[model samples]
Target: MTMLTIDNLVKTYAGEASRRAKSRSGTDRTAVANAAPARVFAVNDVSLEVGDGEMFTLLGPSGCGKTTTLRSVAGLERPDSGRIAVGERILFDGDGSRTTNVPANQRGLGMVFQSYAIWPHMTVFDNVAFPLQVRKRSARPGKREIQERVAKVLETMELGHLADRQATKLSGGQQQRLALARAIVIEPPLMLLDEPLSNLDAKLRESLRYELKRLQRELGITSIYVTHDQIEALALSTTIAVMKEGNVLQTGRPREVYERPNCRFVAEFIGTSNFLRGTVASREGDLVDVDTDAGRIRLESPVRVPVGEEVIAAVRPECFEISRTGWGNRPNEWSGTVTNRAFLGDAVDHIVRVGQGSIRVRGNPAISIEPGTEVHLATDPAKVTLVPVG
Candidate 1:
């Protein structure tokens, strides 16, 4: 069953207009520009369904509406249009003229912010217990129950030793763990994280990524995370929605989005891709021949490209093989000079200058190759992808 559903969400802000005039070549030119805008859409017609116990992520650059979408789902921001449903309850519905705006307090959601929002004056025990106390009112948990719950959550988060310490005295990682514990103490049905690890150091963030995923799985709570970090999104999310300028460009599993991008924007945004432009010369079954400045190449793409039509093919950096031997029976082969080389621990990156452009190739670090040397690069035809133009 789906835990959450968002349909055609929209948010906008408004602005004013100004005019400017310029003269060039004895001719007068006028331009009208809006000074900001009153109704600037932060999120535009976005829709998604997250399954129960699934980890869904809204991954994009800042100002792409990822955080705005998250905020809208949490009831912190009301959308200008559309509907949001949690389980069987309709949180917000703009259609059918039905308007229901559930308050954030009433929504069963646990939110962990980027900043460790633990109170400096409070002890770790009090911080984690605050939610339970607030919810239970006069019938708060007994001392034994509180202690047991706190101890269990702390142990799960690996911060049991710091339970007695003040929140301010703990390290950045410990504070983050405390924040997470506080959120999970109430055991909300849905979890929302907004760049929770952005404030931590690089090494700490790297280590915490695994811990966060494990905790989320163990708790079995449906989660929606917002972040601009590509590596974090790729490593943590079961499905990723790549957004830009208030619109979702693509939504799919990480591997699907990376391996077979539907458009040029998705191809460039997800990872490094070498784009080759050419005209379709011939087609046979799943194979299509493209005529380029360097030579004619055969690619295995399901997309049917009409003859004489211009198309762009994308190949990942790690997909090509660099070697001194000539292309024996490989379908796609190109000869180029290595313009630059860089060793990146596990792999070596090479910039090969082919016809009109240079392409990046990644190979094993142990494979020795130097700049200014001519090398033959071969790739399986089946690996090449033909994506529609943006």
Candidate 2:
């Protein structure tokens, strides 16, 4: 079932010139008089459908409007024109003539922001219980019910023992968990997480990433997650929408998006991709043969392009098989000198100087090869991706 629907969402802002003018003159009227600023489209014609119990991620770089789009759905920012509905209940409908905008609190959606907005003065238990206590008189749960709910949520978050501790006294990870506990306490139809784990250290962030996935699965809560971290998105999302400059470039399952990026931006942004520019030499069904500077490369791709047309063959580092000896007669094999190598604990990254250009190859950490050593890299045709030239 579709839990949330965002259609034709557009949110605009006065360009930075307006803000600069305001800073210089100290007045909004004066700023407007100084210059007619162009409108900046924070979110332009963005639309998405989130299914029940799925983690839908809006992945992109900074200033790409992922946050703005998430904020619009949260009612933190009213969109210029769009319709947002949650399970048939309209949260926002802004189409010039008629507007139906619900207050953020009234939307009843769980939100865990970048900041762990826990009340400092409140105890750990109180922090989670506050949401339930503030409900309207008729809707409010009984004192005992609130305690049970809060206790259950806190226990789920592994903070049950610290229920009496001051919110400020907890560690960073615990506080983040507390915030999540508070959000899910209400059992909302949809959850909005805006880089909630960004503040934590790298190690902690990784630990919580799986923790969050587990919680979402156990709770069966449909969530819209916003983040710039590609690996995090790939690890946690059921579906990922790659956004750029207020536009969504592609949306698909993690594997589908990672394996078959629709465009160059997506191929580059999702992860490190070694792009080989070429003209399509031939095509038979889904298999494409591209002649590039690196050499002739064969790949299986769903994207159809005429022979002799320009295309880019995007190959991921991990897709290549690195070996000391040559794999004779392989379909996509290239012999190169190891220009650089880095130990990544679990894997080793080798920058091999292949043909006119270098391509990175990730392989087993146990098979370490020193720089300047000759190596052979081979990949299956199915592993290479044919990205269309834009």
Candidate 3:
């Protein structure tokens, strides 16, 4: 079953024009001359469908409207246009004919903000029980029921020992866990997390990401996560929607998005890639011959390009092989000078200069290539992708 559906959503803010105008000014010109435009498209014509028990992620850079789209679904921000449906309920419809606009509290959605949002004065138990206590007096659970429910959720979140401790006294990771407990205590059908781990340190964030995904799977809760971190999105989500300037450029499984990107923007945003600009010289079944400044090469491409049309080809850093011998007998190979080398713990990154552009290649440091050394690099033609450049 599709748990949530967001269709043609749009959000425009009045403060964007002012920010853009300020960005275009020179350092010496301190005085502002004119008022900026009044409209900014925070989320523009975005649509998505999330399946039940699936972890969906809105992944992008900052100011890409990932958070805004999440907020609109939470009913915290009303869309200027679009329809939002959760299960069989219509939450927001812009046509005015549908009178249903469920308030956030009544929407049965759990939210975990980046700041944790736990009360410092309350114990973990109280924080988790607060949601149940806020409902109408008649609907409130009895004391015994509340205690059992609170304990159950705390145990599930692995915060049972900290249940008696004040939220303020817990560690950053514990506090984040407490926040999750609080949000899930209500048993909402959908959970919305907005950069929930951004406040934590890098190591802690990395550890908690796995824990969070495990917990979500155990509970079988449909969740929508928003983050600017590509790694987090890739590691945690069943599907990721890549956004740019209020538009959703692509949405697919992590491997699909990474291996078969729809455009240059998506290919560059999701991870590191070496882009080669070229023109299509010829075409065969799944392969296309690309002519670049450095040399002519044949690459496997699912995307078609007419002969003589300009295109950009992208290959991931880890996909290339660095060897002392030239592509003696291989079809797709390039020779270039090693411009820079960085020794990453697991793999060394090499910047190979080809013609006027540099392509990053990742390999073991044991290969023995030094900066300024001429080297030959080869990549499987089947792995190369030709993307249309706009």
Candidate 4:
């Protein structure tokens, strides 16, 4: 079931007064006799649908419009044009002659921002119960109900024992939980999280990541998260939308996006890959043969290209199997010298230089190869991915 829908969402900002007006395309057009200032599109024609009970993440670098899209859905920023809906209720629709926009306070969405935003003067219990206490007179819950709801939410967040403590007196992680507890008390239809872990230390952030996922599944609340951290998105999201420069480049399940990226940017952004620029040498069903400076490599890819078409073959470091002896006549086998090596505690990485390009291979620490040693690398065809060149 669809929980949230956004269509043709576009947001733009006007520059400072009276400098020469820039065009919408960002081209330095010659100033007309009298023209309006140029408009910069923060989010350009973005559309996406998020399913119920799925943790959807909008992932991209800064200035890529992930936050703008999230804010628009939260009714925090009014878009220049777009429609935002949850389940059948239209929170924002700018399509018709009469536009409909619901205010943020009325949207009833639970949101956790980068900052905890805890009320220092209030106790943890009061912070979570405040939402219930401030509802319209007829909608407000009774004292007993409010107290019970707050207590339940605090316990779920593992902060029940600190309920009487001042909100600011808790640790950073606890404050984050307090913010989440407050949001959960309302039982919102959808939750919007914007880099909610960015402010915490690495250890706390990682610990909270698993905790948040467990809590979400327990509550079964649909959530839309925005973040630039690729690992965080991969670890926590069920679906991911990769965005770039105000446009969504691709959307898919976390594994699909990571293993089979649609474009070069997606492959480069989602994770590290050894990109071997080559041309399609041959094709037989899903198995493709590419000729590169390193060698003629074979890959199992869903994308089919014409013979002699320019392409880039990408493979993850962990996908390659490295050994001291050559695998006799393997489909994707190449011999190279290990020019560099690194010990990463649990895994070892070796930089092997073949003809002109180098491929990084990572594996269990037991397979570490010495520098200057001749090593043979081979990968499963199914693990090699093909990327179309721009």
| Best-matching candidate per lDDT | 2
Instruction: In candidate 1, list every pair of residues with a backbone clash.
Output: 13-38, 13-39, 13-40, 14-37, 14-38, 14-39, 15-37, 15-38
- Measured on C-alpha atoms, candidate 3 has an lDDT of 0.89
C-alpha RMSD of each candidate structure in angstroms = 5.0, 2.2, 4.4, 3.2
Write model 1 residue lDDT over 245-338, tens digit each, in one string: 8999889998888888888887887878988888899999999988776567778888877999998878899999998776677778888989
**Candidates sorted by TM-score, best first:** 4, 2, 3, 1
Error of 2 at 133 (Å): 0.9
Taking all chains together, the TM-score of candidate 4 against the true structure is: 0.95
- Tens digits of per-residue lDDT, candidate 4, 21-61, equal 44233334444324666678899999999999999999999
Please list the C-alpha lDDT of all candidates, in the order they appear: 0.85, 0.93, 0.89, 0.92
Off by over 4 Å in 3: 15-37
| Candidate 1 ranges with C-alpha deviation above 4 Å | 15-38, 136-143
Tens digits of per-residue lDDT for model 2, 53-149 = 9999999999999999999999999898999999999999998587999999899999998999999999999999999999999999999999999
All candidates: TM-score: 0.91, 0.95, 0.92, 0.95
Q: Which pairs clash inside model 4? A: none
Of models 1 and 2, which has the larger TM-score?
A: 2
